[model samples]
Target: MMSRPLATALRDATLLGAALLDVFVHVTSDEPLRMAVALAAASLLLLRRRLPLLTFLLTLPSVLLSDAIFASLAALYTLATITRRRTLLAVCAMAYTLSDMTRWTPSPHLDLWNPSALITLGYTAATAAAPVFLGQLVQARRDLSLRLTEISQARDHERRLSAQAVLAEERAQLAREMHDVVSHQVSLIAVRAGALQVATQDAEAKQAAATIRRLSVQTLNELRHMVNVLRGSHNRPTELTPQPSLTDLRRLIDTSGIDTELTTDLPGDLPPTLQRAVYRTIQEALTNVRKHAPGATADVRACFEGDTVRVTISNTAPTRPALPLPSAHYGLIALHQRAALLGGTVTCGPTPDGGYRLRLELPVKQEP
Candidate 1:
């Protein structure tokens, strides 16, 4: 492709060459002064783009003094392409009217009122209009193309924003579902477990009931945490509430409504975020058991091994038929994401004994 400067130089050269050729072809006299003036006028066409009005003014003398028609036409075309339409029209009208008065000749004895003189004037007007019309047409096409490009870019931007808005709305809907359905059901499970634990006499039955209630309370805390996060700047009352920590795990396990045990040897001082992740991991594991293995016995263990905290919750197969409950399939996935964000990992799957096991491993400290 031609560089801009090279292309412009080539265009100016072509216009200058055309003007000189026209002057040479139309020269009615071989006078040296007329030839020199015509050549000067043609040379001025090279500067037309940079100084179009000045070039046109310089070429006007050649048009009036000699028959350098093409030189004047080139200058007028350059001006028409660069200047406004009204300006070009006014200049063209004035220049040609002067030319007709000074240089146009119909016949030796004919006056301005003669039909031949009117024809000559009309021909000169047409000659001036031709290049101006072409310049305006080219400018109009360029403007239209630029406007189309702007409109296309604006449409693409609108589409991107619309997609973002849709994603935000979907996230808000998911938050609503978690709050309305999951939190409400988990709270009921906790309440039922608490009542059963208080009313039971068997050591194993009481232990299981306590575990259910404990886990339910933990789930409620975590749910509140997530709700606050989703609410953003809504300025709700829950925004300032404290989040759950590892210290709450014992209380959490004591509320589960199934036979469950918790053994933990965690540090007293852990990062608040990591504590929350650990609590949520255990809460979600118990919630899964409550949903899928209603009468199953479960074991939960947490310990600091080297530089990491590991928690494992395992439940035996359900002792009764599982309840039919609607599931969004998001609980464990959400738990996995929370662990990952804290630079931890979670694994949950069926065990060889036809049971479920959820394991979480997190760093002892918050990742930088």
Candidate 2:
């Protein structure tokens, strides 16, 4: 590719050569003064872009003295392309027209209204207007190209912002799930191990329980740190875990140690978002049961009802008072957020039988 300065220099050389050829064809070398003025006008074309107005003024004398007006036309066009001053361009065009219309050695007693003279004046005006209009057209085209480039850059910037916002939202969601689900289960393990360490009589069994409790506590600490990092207010990049779906419900219940009964009749081809919402709803409900209702049994029922799939988790009253523990209490809020995103609803309240119930309902086909 040719560099800009090199290309510009080459173009100036070409225009100067064309102007010199015009001078050679019209202005005779036998006339020393006319030839010198024409050559000087052509040489001034090299400086047209840098000093357009001065170059045009200098070339006008050559147009009046001889027929070599190529340099003057080129200078006028260069001026028109670079400046937005319309009045100045019109004045320059008129100057060129008047200069081209008159001869240096005027005949005494020349008619002011000759038909041939009027025709010559009209032709000179039209020729001068040609370069002005063409230069304006080139100027408008360059402006339009620059405007289009700016618009394209703005759209690309907006797209990047939208993508970052989506990624940040997903990271916050993952952080919520880890806090509600993983933290809840680890706390349970720590609680159980603490009880076993106190209740067991064998030295080896007590030591094992103590080890488990200590490790569980450490794991919970690391998990809390990870959650904080994931929910970074600044929205930095982070790793994501696999999402839970309805198929994992059975294993979740078994490992939860909450004495829960699971009954699900969901379609196998359910959308991933719908499946995830169902699974998280049940998990959060069970976690709540384990936290607030000790030694209580839960019943999890999920099935299709018309166009909606309904999941209900009901737990009996606690057999013993629940031990106080540290909690952020964001489980139900996160569940509600997840349901809202899927165009669903989550409702929970105390039951008439002194127990708690959480219900989730979602449509099989979501709306846009």
Candidate 3:
């Protein structure tokens, strides 16, 4: 690609050569002086981009003296393209008008009605208007193209940010799921192994059970470390805190500012994984209530109906104004994904009494 200065120099040199040829061909008298003046005016075109006003002013005398048309028009065009300032444009117009008026020789019988005089005036007006008008159009186009490029760049940046945000959210959800599912199962394994280690009579069987219990505990610790690494700095304090089972529900309610009532008909020895899921579901629902409907009373109920367990948490509208909080609105989505993974489903929506309700139902027995 050619550099801009070199390209401009070549263009100006071509226009100058053409203007010199036109002057030499058309005007016959004072060949030496006219050629010198025309050459000087054309040379000024080389500086038009850097010093347009000065070049335009300097070329006016040459245009008037030898009618260096191309050089004069190029200077005017450069001036208009570089600046939209009315004062500068007006100065350029005045200089050109003065040059045209002074250069024209009035006929011996000159009058307002003289055909030659009228023609010269019209030609002068065209010379002044045409180049400047063309230059203004070019300037407008350049400005519009620059604005379009900036707007396109801004939109691309926004798209990249949105994609990063989505990826981060997905990673967080994966971390949460790993913590909920793997941790619960490992804890249950450790508990069962511990019970077996105590109950068994044979020394070999007891040692095997003890090994299983120790490995299960080690696996749970490794799983937590992996989750912490994946979560990075965006993980909440709750994520790092110890997992709470259904038995901790009362303690959770006591810490919450809102009035909450919990009623459970769940069996005491339910699978630990199912208990963890129920606890997480209720926890998420209560968090939503605290965030979206602050000061609202909530009711949490867990019941066993045959082979299924249903956990429902519902909250009334806030008695006080809701607090302002930034929410990603993906909590329910993560909950639904968790339920689906456990061969269950979660339903959430506004209650009939102008409140919110979230219900999670899981099978009594879920494959490990």
Question: Using lDDT as the measure, what is the rank order of every candidate, best first?
Answer: 2, 3, 1
C-alpha lDDT of all candidate models, in order: 0.81, 0.90, 0.82
Estimate the lDDT of model 1.
Answer: 0.81
Can you write out model 2's per-residue Cα lDDT over 158-208, one digit (the tens) per residue?
999898888778878988999999999999999999999999999989987
Q: Residue 96 CA error for candidate 1 (Å)?
A: 4.1
Candidate 3 residues 63-145, lDDT tens each?
67766667788889989998989687866876786676567444423354878877887778777878888999999999999
Quote model 1's TM-score: 0.54
Question: lDDT winner among the candidates?
Answer: 2
Where model 1 places Cα greater than 4 Å from the true spot, the runs are 1-9, 23-36, 85-88, 104-111, 153-172, 190-368
**For every model in order, what is the number of clashing pairs?**
16, 0, 0
TM-scores, all models, native as reference: 0.54, 0.60, 0.54
How far does residue 154 in candidate 2 sit from its true spot (Å)?
Answer: 0.5
